[model samples]
Target: MRPMPHDHSDHPHALLPPDPALRVKALETILTRKGLIDPAALDELIDTYENRIGPKNGARVVARAWADPMFRAALLEDATRVVADLGFYGRQGEHMVVVENTPQQHNMVVCTLCSCYPWPLLGIPPGWYKSDAYRARAVREPRKVLADFGVTLPEGTSVRVWDSTAEVRYLVLPMRPEGTDGLSEDALADLVTRDSMIGTDIPKVPS
Candidate 1:
């Protein structure tokens, strides 16, 4: 997917960076011309993965973990198998790890080299998540990066950043919110935001 417009504030006199979409389109055109892939079929596949198979799959997983102690233990012990057993397995998400967020420690995921992520669960990664700024700063200065996302953690809370690679990706299991003991699995799923699963933000508390 094409990323949003980039900032050129640091180099006001320099030309803006090349639009990544232009390069992607050029490659797609060349591939289509070479009969490497049909544009229509390619678009269809992308649409299905991006739209049809969305973050709700992950929401369900998070919700189940929240409502079931056994499942949560299984998830924390072996996330790959737990998710696969629940039919959330796929190419980029074949290897997965779950990190728990606690009162004293917060966990966040980043891809230092590339936008490697759990696609089958989280679906498409957000533009900011794939930005150069996030890839660099999330590791260097996590609290500042999180603050930009409007997530202010307590000073005592230690932020642990996990770098995702092609071999394995991570999902953050945000601590369950209070007053949620009565919620159903689907209701709990509603509270599970994509950013929460990524550890940039916490789950939306039920009112």
Candidate 2:
């Protein structure tokens, strides 16, 4: 009797999925073939996101937190609920927690298991954020990673790393920037960067 066709589903190689970039490339190829998208249009789309969505949204959240103590308290206590209160809550961010950074303590976040993140408030995770290099090195060498990101903690400040898992997501509520005292919430939000929301960068001073 002839052997049945081999089954590969249980194989170790089969257990690993293809890279997401491959899927994106396949989709782009299909779109190009169908004449639905041109190369220039695709480049423009990428630029739109690079300039607009992620960092800009994060800056808005930070600015609001700085101007309103009550809102800040709500954000720290329950990030998802508070963010939803501002109309930013959505699919991936049904559960969220905001960690506060202080003079004595600094917080950094990572998804050691997977790239689980609060997407609604922060938008898409940057390319580097989802890389194995970042995930492996973040927990293993947090201070060095923060330094590379241009964030320097004080000599005595304690570093706290929050590892986001599938069940819960996290955001970092950075301390309010100086020179932003009299800025309105709308004006302040523009200074917030996605990095600050993730604890990698701090808000820039208003010029």
Candidate 3:
């Protein structure tokens, strides 16, 4: 047996339903009633973001950077232009900066104000990325946030948190997995997960 979810309408984070599923449903209903959104279009949009556009574009970028030193340097130096060169630039990704994760330091991205993200590369932002808890705690306790996301770093590794805004967005360049030097770029791209690009996880090594 399972207990029912309680309403948190009285809480400070009111307007946000207690359950995230319910929160999204409520928001959808409100928007639909106001004639601000169309249900069919919304469903199609979510489907496109989730399946068609999500992560694959970012994986291509990551794979290219891993296979080419020059591209990696250019990406880290001028992500906005470099990513646009690959045709992954749009509304939310106009001004982009890329951060590299190294042996000694890790980088994480968050937008405390709102859900500013690179839509062309990553598609729609995940629910947690826009949650109040993540927005508030990621900056204050990045290690804990990473831990919550099932990522653990060595004690000596330092974490750097990047705050995103309407003006500038960030893309995390996760370290290329070991033993992948011989893999083709397409195969390597398969190892790059959406969470890895967000700095919440790392690229998986092929079996």
By TM-score, the best candidate is 1
For model 3, state the Cα shift of residue 93 in Å. Answer: 1.0
Q: What is the lDDT of residue 88 in candidate 2?
A: 74
Worst 10 contiguous positions by lDDT, candidate 1: 8-17
Ranking by lDDT: 3, 1, 2
Q: Report the error of model 2 at residue 24, Å.
A: 4.8
Compute each candidate's TM-score over C-alphas: 0.85, 0.76, 0.78
lDDT of 2 by residue, 1-207 (tens): 987787656755333346877767777787899999898988876775566445566567777888889888888887777778777766567888888889998888889888887776777798778989889988888889988888888899888888886667788888887877788888888777787777777777788
lDDT of 3 by residue, 90-183 (tens): 8678888889999999999999998888888898899999999999999999999999999999878999998886678888999999999789
Tens-digit lDDT track for model 1 on 38-145? 989988998978787768988999999989999999999999999999888897898999999999999999999999989889988989999999999999999999
Model 2 stretches astray by more than 4 angstroms: 1-53
Report the number of the highest-lDDT candidate. 3
Candidate 3: count the clashes.
Answer: 0
Model 1: residue 32 alpha-carbon error in angstroms: 2.8
Error of model 2, residue 165, in angstroms:
1.4
Lowest lDDT 10-residue stretch of candidate 2: 8-17
RMSD of each: 7.3, 6.1, 7.9
